[model samples]
Target chain A: MNAKTSSPIPPAEWIVAGMGLLVFTAVLGLMVWDAVAGDQSPPRITVEVDSITRSGDGHLLKFRARNDGGETAAEVVVEGELPASGGETETASATLDFLPAHSERKGGFFFKAQPERETVRLRASSFREP
Target chain B: MVRRGPKTLMSRRASATHKPAPRGTSRHFLRALARAFAGAIVFGLPLLMTMEMWWLGFHADRGRMALLFILSLPLLVGLSHYSGFEPTFGWVDDVVDTFVACAVGFVSSGVILLLFGLIEPGMAASEVIGKIGLQTLPASIGALLATGQFASPEEREADQKRFRKYQGELFLMMVGAIFLALSMAPTDEMMLIAYMMTPTHVLGLIFLSLVVMHAFVHAVESSGKAYVPSGTPFWSVFLRITIPGYVIALLISALILWAFERTDSCGPATLMGSVIVLGFPAAIGAGASRLII
Candidate 1:
């Protein structure tokens, strides 16, 4: 309480408090905006076979998936398949744990045969709403 | 050193109350800023690196996130009251320090998350705030605790003396519980462990939490007379401190789970199971605070 002693509210404390209040207010405003006017749609995934490259005795089928919707997609199952000569299929899959809205996840599957020559199909099997 | 509790409120009310010696002011702002930076890195880096935490920030319920922020206010106040980075002379000063710690935490989280590309401009407003806000809890606590941990020996000694009060002890336990609980809250493992446990295992865990809480507090108390006394009736210590510490740990675990939306789809039985599973580590952290913090 003395004049020479530290004040209960120091000048520097005010600066710190102001900075904190500014951030807190900005964050709160953003959150409020998201709550009131944000998008509430679910995640929509589109899977594509980007490229087929040759690997050792096999073909590496590169694939990519994009989440173009509002929410996140969890455990997105992307399946790549090559129909074989005997009506059989060689399938490889990759499961992405999470893919946020407007984001992309790249992954691939490998086939023993040349995917460029074989009937290769890449598709999004399933995804959960995260 | 004098130990007093009831006198604290009275002395605090009086305008003429004594203040601890002021820390030197030649580089006060710079020193505080540096401490806050150090605290943020020490406490917040792990959460920033967690992929699940990034996922949770976007998908988690926004209402609950706001509620968690609301709850953090009082917790910060309590932390400042007991072991803040700077010595506070009154409630108003404590409030100011709490804000400062919050600012440091928010800035630190924003910078680090941005550097990691966890937050992108393309993301929604909620996503950015949620990510930074979630990390702020522990970072702010670290900022508040920075003073005591990084202070000169004399100042550290002075702060240690303040921890003798009952409320101070409780606040320490809460900090420890929150720190440990939060470290694992964003992981799938908590729910995985809950699923693996039978009802009987949950009961066993509850018993284990109490036992450990009691044992650790007893050991800390008996080892030093400077600690809160343990010579009183055994039942009193067990009921007053140990039980309450375990309860605090359980509540902290539940709060963390709820904030992360781990309990959204869970039934009440499963929710209780999850709390108990996480409560085990939380209780241990609470008890171990006597030695660690």
Candidate 2:
């Protein structure tokens, strides 16, 4: 211990230090509870269209990808498909960097053909374990 | 055990000139807190910007995170003992400084994450807490080190004098190892590099790490901030400091890897390889800490 201080500590400084103690205790408590009892379910991803809007040459399909489980999903690929008149399906895909457990990420796909709400099919194609 | 140095004399003279009122004391604390914020940003920016760090925040093993958090209190206390934002007189001051550093770490991390858009509105509380909490330890250490990093030469000498004991030296090495390891351990590249290397490469890397660590220690010693007393045998210094320092680095690397969940899926061989890969930087950090701190 280097004993150099001679002045008494200010009350305001002590109050701030007390607040810091509270923050540390709360975070420590949360971490302990999470470690002992929190869920560890694998990622369960669900993709849904949020809105369809027009871009320059194509319509942009904005979608939300939600992770409903307790693990994070990475490189999440979502696909949107629309059935064409010629019987071929028009497919557009988007990738999200990460969808943390119990969290949502927003992404968009572009399609030249306008997609109807009922006919547009959106699905989370795949996700890598993170 | 009090070593009266120039710093003490300077402080005494200053106090004699003007008695420090409560307002002055509070203002001094505020300045230290500001320095802590700057230190947190300087040391924590890389991890704050790293993508793997963000992902690990949510998915990392909670038990390990808790353990890391628990370990950080003592680490910060020890660091505060050496070079806190301000000089501390006792254990109570050291503990108070530790918490204040943590508070600075948390606030700095939160504000930066928000500015970067990593923490968005309506985000899960757990995710936000996880990200901020995971970053807090390293940033707190940085906060504790602000004074050492920015001190006047005389003040730095005084601080360094307090850590001349063997235990104190080793503790500083551990802090250095953890600081560097925390920044590098969360990356996928550690695994990828380990996977790409053959056994011969691993052996080569092990030899290189030891040589580099020893070289750093030797350089520091020759520069006159000598940890090795004069007339000490070469092999004795090597055995006493360099070897143990390297071992501490390796252990820290392994611990950090486990904390980041990088070892969860790997086999023993891969795990060992990853540890060695990370150990290189940790060794450098350990060796260089003597010079830096």
Point to the candidate with the largest lDDT: 2
RMSD of 2: 4.4
Please write out the lDDT profile of model 2 over residues B135-221, one tens digit for every residue.
Answer: 887788888888866554556777777767788778888877877878999898999999998889999999998899888888767
Among incorrect, acceptable, medium and high, the docking class of model 2 is: medium
How close to the true structure is residue A83 of candidate 1, measured as C-alpha lDDT? Answer: 85
lDDT of each: 0.78, 0.83
Question: Can you give the TM-score per candidate against the true fold?
Answer: 0.79, 0.89
* Residue pairs with clashing backbones, model 1: none
Q: Which stretches of candidate 1 lie over 4 Å from their true place?
A: A1-5, A8-13, A46-68, A77-95, A102-125, B1-26, B120-122, B223-227
TM-score leader? 2
* DockQ of each model vs. true complex: 0.34, 0.58
Error of 2 at B119 (Å): 0.8
The TM-score between candidate 2 and the true structure equals: 0.89
